[model samples]
Target: MFANIPTYWCAKCDDITQFSLKVKEPPQFTFAIRKAMDDASGPVIPYETNYCDFCCKNCGQPVRVKYDEHEFAMSSYRYLPKAVYLYEFAL
Candidate 1:
């Protein structure tokens, strides 16, 4: 269900804190633990996304993730609140 399951995310700091798009059913929620890292260069490297969790290194501030799926059949993108931009997220 890769194509059908379009999960979304939002970082608290930068990408240090993150969570995956949940079905919002009963006890339905997924989080992650894969912090981003630099590969030789100072540029940040991307990870194998589509899994639940946040890329800690990438997420730098403080964040609160929430999924906002509009197209239930196509793709989904989480709606990061403005507070997220100023969040002081910690592990």
Candidate 2:
């Protein structure tokens, strides 16, 4: 159903990964998500943090990237990269 969403490269898995909105997993947030998506004027909450999680469809390894809806216009949304950064949390 979400095949055409977006894709990014994962160095750990050494392959391209698919993207998914973290919010979509929760049933309660569905209405908020829909509202945000339906709003043509702008994101329901400007500056809202939307996590764009990219994971390997094969191994299931995943990485999270932060994004703000106000960062890009709707027309430029498709051009956004699936992976923004590879975070190294602990030393």
Candidate 3:
């Protein structure tokens, strides 16, 4: 069984709706280093970060959700516009 997930207001849908959560994996890169004395390659290194994306089921609009943190509790969550979120993240 799946745990209860709360629905949020989707402006595009003009009503409350459930959102689908998708996790995006960061990009990976590989580098090669050559030694001055010999022609050899160095080890490969990988880096990545976790990112979450939410889409409204009714309207299929993407939104970025954030929780408001108070002194010791979370007050509420806000849906950020896709344009602003994309600009902020440079995605």
Could you give the C-alpha RMSD of every candidate to the true structure, in order shown? 14.1, 9.7, 14.6
TM-score of each: 0.21, 0.41, 0.33
Better of 1 and 2 by TM-score: 2
- Between 1 and 3, whose lDDT is larger? 3
Query: Could you tally the backbone clashes for each prediction?
Result: 19, 0, 0
Q: What is model 2's C-alpha RMSD?
A: 9.7
Clashing pairs in 2: none
lDDT of 1 by residue, 1-91 (tens): 3233432244333322223444221121123211221111122123212222222335333222322233434454433221121223345
Q: How does candidate 3 score on lDDT?
A: 0.33
Query: In candidate 1, how many Å is residue 17 off?
Result: 8.4
Q: Which prediction has the highest TM-score against the true structure? A: 2
How much lDDT does each candidate structure score?
0.28, 0.45, 0.33
Q: Of 2 and 3, which scores higher on TM-score?
A: 2
Off by over 4 Å in 2: 1-4, 22-47, 71-91
